[model samples]
Each structure stands twice: as structure tokens, then as C-alpha cells.
Target: MDTKLIIIETTTDDKEMANKLSHLLIKEKLAGCVQVNQINSYYEYDDKINNTVEYLIRIKTLSNYYEDVKEFLSKEHNFELPEFISYECKEVSKDYLDWIVKNLNK
Candidate 1:
């Protein structure tokens, strides 16, 4: 079977948490690359609209590692309900895909 590439996304209200998670993922080889971006999130909760600044975390890894990555994030995340969304990459450059595979743990 061909190796499947995936990108998992999540958001945290704390910047420190975002940085820490990103570093941990990389160090543990759960992810080839992690990106943290500042973003504004608007949602409805408790019958009220709320807006907050959040850090978006994007994790790139192989499909085989998704479970491990999700477990780690679930254990370490601070949010009551952290966002854990994964998108399968249908198209990726050959060089970039090779780099990801090379950097990730076997």
C-alpha cells in the first residue's frame, strides 16, 4: 500500500500551549512539521456568540501515525473540547512528500 499523508489541525486559546505542543510533536517524531498560526475564532456557546483569539496548530504526518498523534494531543491539550481534524492529502509535491517521509520516525 502507498503511504498516505495527512494533516491534522487543532486550535488552542493559549499561545504557550500551541508552542509547547508543536515542539513536543516534532521532538517525538509524531509530526514532520508543525505550524502555529494566530487566528480569531467565533463560535456560539451557551446561547451566546463568543469571539476569541486562538492559535491554530497544523500537524503533518503519515496516516499510520494519526492515532499516536491524536492520543498525544488529547492527553496534553488544555481545552475542554479540543479540535482534532484531519485532512488527507490527495496531492503533494514529490520532493515535499519525500522530505516528510524522511523526517518522520519509521
Candidate 2:
């Protein structure tokens, strides 16, 4: 069977925003765990190259809860087009995957 765990990645402009989103995800049981990191990002927007210091949020949760997570981010994120991406974890440890499933509401 395929692993049910997924890693959701997104960037936030500030630490406060990242923490707020993390708390929402955990409190709502949409994510089992969230890791926040400080990152320097470079990207192109409106034909201009931009560089920024941002927070990278890695959210771990069951794949089934992704839609709810996406909805919450869409409404709460500060960016016009937030970077929300999910990758199925093909080789997560059995115990970790179990933890994610157990923490999810559903």
C-alpha cells in the first residue's frame, strides 16, 4: 500500500505569520507536526527578480486532510499567491506515518 503521509511546503513572509499558520494547522488537527525554518529566497515576480528572507514551513499530515489544509491557507495566508505544495512521502517510517494518521481528525 502507498504511504498516506504527505509533506506540505509553503513560505511565509514573517515569523509571526508562520507561527500563526502553524498553530492553526495543529489546533485544527489538519497537521500532525509543523517545522519552521528561516530561509533566504530568490524568485521572479512581475518581471523583476526579488530576494527575501522568509520562513519555510513544512507541515506533515495525512494526505486525506490536504483539502482542509489548503482551504485554511488560502484564506489566511498573506501572499497573493502563496506557495502551497504537497509531496506524498513514499518511504516514511511506519511509526511516523502511524503518528500522522493518529493525529489527524477523520
Candidate 3:
């Protein structure tokens, strides 16, 4: 199985959403770990040229699970245009990578 790290963004800055998603991912054995952080302004959308707060969730999972993870995100996400992005890991610390594989198995 290939390991992948996904970055998902939401419209609202509610920490609760991040927490819930993280728990769901782990509980369902779809992701190893999820870290949510408050980030500065990135871009404007919907004619709103202003600064806003946002949370970035970093999820660790296998490549094959992206579709399932995306589905779960889409169904639970409140934003109409939530960001669904993924990054392939070419190299990672052995210990960390092993942790991901272990936690992501049901």
C-alpha cells in the first residue's frame, strides 16, 4: 500500500469541524493521523477580497483510500467548495511511515 498525505480546507474556521473529521478518520481506520492548524489568509473567493481565518487539516493515509476518504469528507463537510487536495510522499521517516500503515488498517 502507498502512503499519502492529504490537505483539506474548509470555509469556516470552526475548530469543531476539524476535530470531528480527525476523529472520524482515525475511528474508521482510514487515516493514521490528522493535524489541524490555524493558518493565515491565502486567497479570496466569491467576490470577498478580504482576509479570513482558516484551518488546514493534514491527514495521513494510504493512496488507495483517497476515494473513500474524499467521500467521507464530501458528505460531512459543510462548505459548498471545500478544498480536497492530496500529496504523494516520495520519502518519509521509516518510523513515521510505519505508524501510518498501522493506524490506517481496520
Ranking by TM-score: 1, 2, 3
Q: What is the TM-score of each candidate against the true structure?
A: 0.95, 0.91, 0.84
Encode model 2's per-residue lDDT on 1-106: one tens digit a residue: 2248889999998899999999999998889999999999999989999999999999998777788899999999989899999998888888878777777744
Those runs of model 3 whose alpha carbons end farther than 4 Å from true positions after fitting are 3-12
Q: List the residue pairs that clash in candidate 1.
A: none
Clashes of each: 0, 0, 0
lDDT of 3 by residue, 1-106 (tens): 6555444434446778888888888899878878888886667668877677877788778788888888998898767767787878777788987878887764
lDDT of 2: 0.88
Error of 3 at 37 (Å): 0.4
Between candidates 1 and 2, name the one with more favorable lDDT.
1
Per-prediction CA RMSD (Å):
1.3, 2.0, 2.2
Q: Of the pair 2 and 3, which is ahead by TM-score?
A: 2
The lDDT per prediction is: 0.93, 0.88, 0.76
Weakest ten-residue segment in model 1 by summed lDDT: 97-106
Q: Where's the lowest-lDDT run of ten residues in candidate 3?
A: 3-12
lDDT of 3 at 29: 88
